[model samples]
Target: MSDPRVAEHMPLLSKKWDTDVAKKFIASKEQRWARDGLGHWAFLVDGRYVGWGGFQKEGDEWDFGLVLRPDAFGLGLRITREAIEFAIADDRIPFVTFLLPPSRKNLSALQRLGARHFGEVNYDGARFLRYRLETR
Candidate 1:
C-alpha cells in the first residue's frame, strides 16, 4: 500500500506515509483479508498492482469501493460492474453500500448498477455520499 501513485485517489487519506506506517497498513489489510475474505484486494494488471477493490462490513452495513491509479481510470466502470455481480452472487451479503466523497460524484455508474442513494455521512472530517445496492 506504500505506492504513492495509488493513494492519490483515496479522498479520506490526507497524510503521507513513512516506511513503518506503510508496513503497518499493509499488515492490517493482510489480516483483514485473511479473516473474512472481505477486505480490499489489490487490482492487478499484467502482474502490476494498479488499484484495489473490495468490501468492509460494519454491523449490518457493508461498505464497498474501488480505487485505481489515474492511468487506470477507464477501468472504474468495469470494476463497479464486477463488484455488483460479486455482491449478487454472495447470498450472505444482503446488500452493499458505497462511500464516495462529494467531489467524486459518479452517480450514473451507481444508477447503471441499480444502486440507490442512501444519504450522506461524515467520516474523519470528510463528507461522503452513501449509495446502496441490495441483492434481495
Candidate 2:
C-alpha cells in the first residue's frame, strides 16, 4: 500500500481496536516493532490496509507484535502466522515474544498459537502478559 494510504487508514483501522491503548500504539511508530534488515510488514487484504505484524529487538530478545483491523482479524492472524514462519526461516531471531494484555480473550489466542507465558511487565502504563515463541 502507498504510504499516503497507510497513513490515512491507520487511524480508521485503529479505531476498531476500541481501546486507547491500541490507539496509542498506532500513533507511535517508535513503539511498534521495527528493525534494520528485518522489519514489520503491513498486512493488506484485497487492497485495503488492515494491520501490521513483525519483529523487533526487546531487551536481548526479539519480540513480535500484530495489530489488525477488527474486520480483518481472522485473515490477519493467518498472514501473521506466515510472517512468523518467514522470520524463523531467516534464522536471525531464535525466539519471538508477544506482549499481550492479561485478558482471557488474548491469552486464549496466544495459547492456541503455542505462545508460552513466561513473565509480565508494566510498559506505557499498561501491564502486559509476556509470551515467548520457542524455536526449534
Candidate 3:
C-alpha cells in the first residue's frame, strides 16, 4: 500500500497502511481465505511480485479482484483473464463478482473478460459499481 502508484488508485487503503497495519490486514485476509476457501493470491512474474488476484465473498457472491502496480499495467488483462479462467474451471464457484470504484477506468477491459454490470453498492461508506461474470 506504500507504493505511490498503487496507493493512488486505492484511496481507502492508502491512508492507513503502516507496517503493522499492513501486516494485520494481510493476516486477516489470509485467515478469511483459509477459513472460507475464498481469497486472493499474489501475482508473480518469474518470482517477482507484481500484484494480486483473487476472490472474496460479498453478499452471497464470490467477488473477483485484481490489483497491479503501474509498472505492471500491461499485464493486468492477461492476469485477469487467467484468473477468470481459473474461476470458471472451479465448479464450486458458480459465478464471480466485482466491486470497482469509478476511478478504476477499466470497464472495457472487464467487458472484454465477460463481466457485466449488475448494480451499484455502498460499502464501507464508499460507493462501488458491481459486476458479475458467469460461465459461458
Each prediction's Cα RMSD? 2.4, 7.1, 1.5
lDDT of residue 21 for candidate 3:
95
Error of 3 at 108 (Å): 0.9
For model 2, residues 1-136, the per-residue Cα lDDT tens digits are 2244333423233333346755575556554433345556677878999877677676677778776666666774578578768767877777788877654244566677688988887876667777888765
What is the Cα-based TM-score of model 1? 0.84
Per-prediction TM-score to the true structure, in the order listed: 0.84, 0.68, 0.91
Runs in model 1 deviating more than 4 A are 1-9
**Pairs clashing within candidate 3:** none
lDDT of 3 by residue, 52-91 (tens): 8688877677888788877888998899888888888988
Q: How accurate locally is residue 124 in candidate 3, as Cα lDDT from 0 to 100?
A: 84
Best by lDDT: 3
Task: Point out the higher-scoring one by lDDT: 1 or 3.
Answer: 3
Query: Candidate 1 residues 6-117, lDDT tens each?
Result: 5544666766778877678778878877876778778887888778878877567778878787788788888877877888898768899988887764569788888899
Worst 10-residue stretch by lDDT in candidate 3?
Answer: 8-17
Worst 10 residues of 1 by lDDT: 1-10
